[model samples]
Target: MLANPATALELDHVSRHFDGRAVLSDISLSIPAGKITCLLGQSGCGKSTLLRIISGVDRPDPGGRVLVGGTEVAGPGRFVEPEDRRIGFMFQDYALFPHLSVADNLAFGLRHLSRPERRERVAKVVERIGLGHLLDRYPHSLSGGEQQRVALARALAPRPSILLMDEPFSNLDQGLRERVRRETVDILRETGTTAIMVTHDPQEALAVGDMIVLMRAGRIEQVGTPFEIYDRPCSAYAAEFMGPCNRLTGLWSQGRIETPIGAFRADLDMPDGALALACIRPQALSIGPDGQGISARVMAKTFTGESEQIDIMVHPLAQTLRMHSHVRIPMGIGDKVSLQLNGAQVHVFPEEPGTDDPLDQS
Candidate 1:
């Protein structure tokens, strides 16, 4: 864990509600300075609500504390207005003023500065965002990517201490989104700005963020680096949500887990005959002849030039297990293939209540 004592933003037991419905529930996390943190979750998971609270666009319950630069911004009947919080927000819709030209939009928040200072700030931001040529153009005349840059430039025009982004890349196409997000990350790092972005795209969160936060329901499930989360997920939900994983229910037997696929060893403490769930990454799987391992029929295959997605039917054990391989194996539908499970360590989770007993081998 990268622990920095100099945190730029801190949320202590934050919670929010909308018309009696809870949106954020007891959220707590500290965002370190000069680091990019991505809040990742599905729609309506309260990641955006947390962002709003941090930006002071929305207030948290009186029991929670919102701190920035070691000062309390919101706590126990106290609230700081959004504009006074020294936080910049990049909305999902870009939020560029339709009537204002790019230059004026970028200069909107600079009323406190002299005309020369405003011109200098806007010029610097426009040049950095690569929108120098489109400064005089209206929002309708600019491309999506250009408008996104303008919005970013406007937020950055005032040199905020913290920056918040709400799905800023969702408006762009897949390829363009990747490119723009990469550029935005580079800019943020170059400026050494502390930022927290809300996004549902796991890949984008992993690719762009220094730290990834996984959220479920209205609370944070886990937080770690991309490599840490991908390789050693804290739970089955975290593993499955971050990417594809084969979850198989099994029983612990003699230092190995006995599943329908076969007995496999794992570095976990499970008593003999204990019911457990094993999560295996697709990349860790290899297939050959079924006679050597657990027999599984080839369910389906989809080739994507670089890799092939092979779905094998591990009957009575799981609905199906999907695996990816670089080489195209010479097999057809209904063919049986042996399974080989190879990885550093597999995550074994305890079975939840009311689930079928994994020890029942009937």
Candidate 2:
């Protein structure tokens, strides 16, 4: 039994191994009731494998336990089948049977109920998704969006306590994806369902999840709200993965890192003279000629919608840096410029092995 009723889903010391390879390492997480949580990570980060463990599709290595609504579903000795767990799952491909009608597919999971109860449950879900008119249609005859709705309705018809979605909108084009994401979020909120989605896209995770669990190399890197993860990243890997940033390495001294661009205060708690790095997001750098900042020369500029990407070569650093600036400074190739850093937008982390960037020692 759960010690806290407010938690809808909980995983304790979950680990998965395949053929002597560890895919997940002692993962533990507690999901509060009625909130959407996103499991975010890059490809091969073991997000999908973790999702499988949560749904009881794959058993975890010996020292693991999964709990739903204070009831133990899987653990070192206990085991629960996927269907018995009463968890709804939405696949990457939507997984709607082409031969079945929309109504039939929605009713499939409701088979455990009486015939009348199944029909009523299916009808309710169809209405909830606003797909009443498409009930008689087959998956092959429906558009991608329609098929996606049908799949969602089918999963929801069972009214599982928790919903698990794996890359649910990856198949749709960019425009359709945004719309569907909004719709899904709205419905999940209206129903007050606890949901966990596995996604590789950072933006999607921020937009869809109330809280995000970032993973890397089969380990939990950090867990926080979107603003907390993006603005206050806990590691260099977390900072870079959230968005593009210019990395600079320097000796940690008096709360500042000396760089070719000039020493800037990074506010990190590290031993003096230890190697550390600064993560400056593109948006943090502003370009101006007579500005009090780092001296640089514009190498190239690529206009991208509201802002232009400025490729600049720092005169003192001799390293080309990229910045995105909204200020329309008309400067051609080889034009001297000054780069300014917005301290509020920058992030700093201690030197860690296997990070995407290494400080230039030379």
TM-scores, one per candidate: 0.91, 0.95
Q: Which residue pairs overlap in candidate 2's backbone?
A: none
Q: State the local distance difference test value for candidate 1.
A: 0.85
Worst 10 residues of 2 by lDDT: 353-362
Q: Pick the candidate with the highest TM-score.
A: 2
Against the true structure, candidate 2 reaches a TM-score of: 0.95
Measured with C-alpha atoms, the lDDT of residue 230 in candidate 1 is 77
Q: Pick the candidate with the highest lDDT.
A: 2
> What is the C-alpha lDDT profile of model 2 across 157-203, one tens digit per residue?
88989999999999999999999889999999999988999998889
Task: Supply the global lDDT for candidate 2.
Answer: 0.86
Candidate 1: minimum summed lDDT over ten consecutive residues — where?
353-362
Model 2 ranges with Cα > 4 A deviation: 356-362
Q: For residues 1-362, what per-residue lDDT tens digits would candidate 1 score against the true structure? A: 23345799889999998898888899999898989999998777889889888988888977999988888889997899998999999999999999999889999999989999999998888777788789789999988888888888899999999999999999999888888888899999988998899988888898988899888778888999999987878777787778877877888887777777666776677788898788788887888976887677898999999999999887685488888999878988789988777755466676565643222223
